[model samples]
Target: MNIFDLLLEADILVQISIFILLGFSILSWSVIFHRVFTLNIAHKKLKLFENEFWSGIDLASLYQKSLSRRNKLNGAEQIFYVGFKEFSKLYQMKRCSSETIISRTLDTMHTAINIELKTLEDYIPLIGTIGSISPYLGLFGTVLGIMHVFVELGKTTNNTATQIIHLQIIAPGIAESLIATAIGLFVAIPSVMAFNYLTTQINNLDQDYNNFIDEFITILYRQIFLNIDSVLNKENKHEETENKTCY
Candidate 1:
């Protein structure tokens, strides 16, 4: 008999199990497609932003360009914007030491990274939960189907003139029960694989954000020292000019 015929004849509980598996399969695939698209976009945006950042552009100019698209900034760009804004604020105030400014800017960037990570992780746990539970749900349906087949067989043997068993009588029922497990595995395998692949993508993006943060902070530190030296040099040149006038 065809799968549809078997499903029609299957026990009610088994039918429910199959329907649930089908639902999980649909939801899992939906999440897989969404994440694939999202992560791919994130990766491309990050690469583009990184290339622009490292192409000898000034930080203030980069910040201004990013500001134009502030609402739509990607992961790496968002980090740069947040970190640079914080550094600019603290540097302008000049009330805090350089160490304090750097520390505060680092904290702000870390918070931005966490927020970006959370956004990337949306709906991922649901996929993991479905993969973990689908097999057990299918197993439950299979066990119930087998019990139903056995109960029916006992009734038939009681009515028969001779105590005999037939392969045809049991084969269809067993086949129906096994279909639940087959569906479960079908749903689970792809969900698990997609989960792993998406998770790796997230981790890679996270690493890129961290590396950028470190490099950006180093640049900020150097700029601070350069400004200090420039001020000291200007003051020394002014004093030398005054000494020449006095002579």
Candidate 2:
């Protein structure tokens, strides 16, 4: 029979499977759209933050501006704040060696990065799982329906008399099987796409964080440490000049 005829002739269980597949498709698509929106906003905010960070702008001023906003910022800014706070604290400590200070600064930044990574990745894995499994579940239902159809087909020995029941059984079973593929496609396409897209974004952000961390740390080492050493050397030179003049 024709496709419409098959659909029209499908049994209740097969129809139910189609409905379930459609539901999963809708749910997966919803997740895809939501995540896309979230990630896009995150990237926008992150770019804004990075530009502010590298602009020779004062961290204190930036921190103050960021803190004033109630819904103003994201994890990238938080990571920067944590790093800047550590840098300032170390600067105040005065007694620490440069090695100790830089090491502590990097350690703090790394921890903050890990926390932000987790926050960014929330609920994404579950979306991938739903995408991967929903189709298989649909296929399982279809298989069971087809098996029942065949079992019904085997029940009678008469040829023409059994054929009508066979059509009723087989039509829905075939439709159900085809829908399993459709459901599989429904679940798999967006899921694979979303999973891959999000993963790539995470990697890019991670690289951006690492690069910025290195650049900012290098800036601190040059500006803070060299200035301190220069002042100390000048003081020693002047003291020696005074001693020579007095002698």
lDDT of each residue in 127-217, candidate 2, tens digit only: 7887788778777767866777777777756788678867775556666557655666777777878888987887787887788789878
Write down the TM-score for model 1.
0.88
**lDDT (CA) for every model shown?**
0.84, 0.72
- Screening candidate 2 with a backbone cut-off below 3 angstroms (N, C-alpha, C), the clashing residue pairs are none
lDDT of 1 by residue, 1-247 (tens): 9989888888899999999999999999999999989999988988898899889999999999989989988698999999999888866653345566778899999999999999999999889889999999889899999988877776664535433554457668978988898888998899998999999999999998899899989888886746765654565555543222211
lDDT of 1: 0.84
lDDT of 2 at 179: 61
Clashes of each: 0, 0
- Every model's Cα RMSD, please? 7.4, 7.3
Per-model TM against the reference = 0.88, 0.80
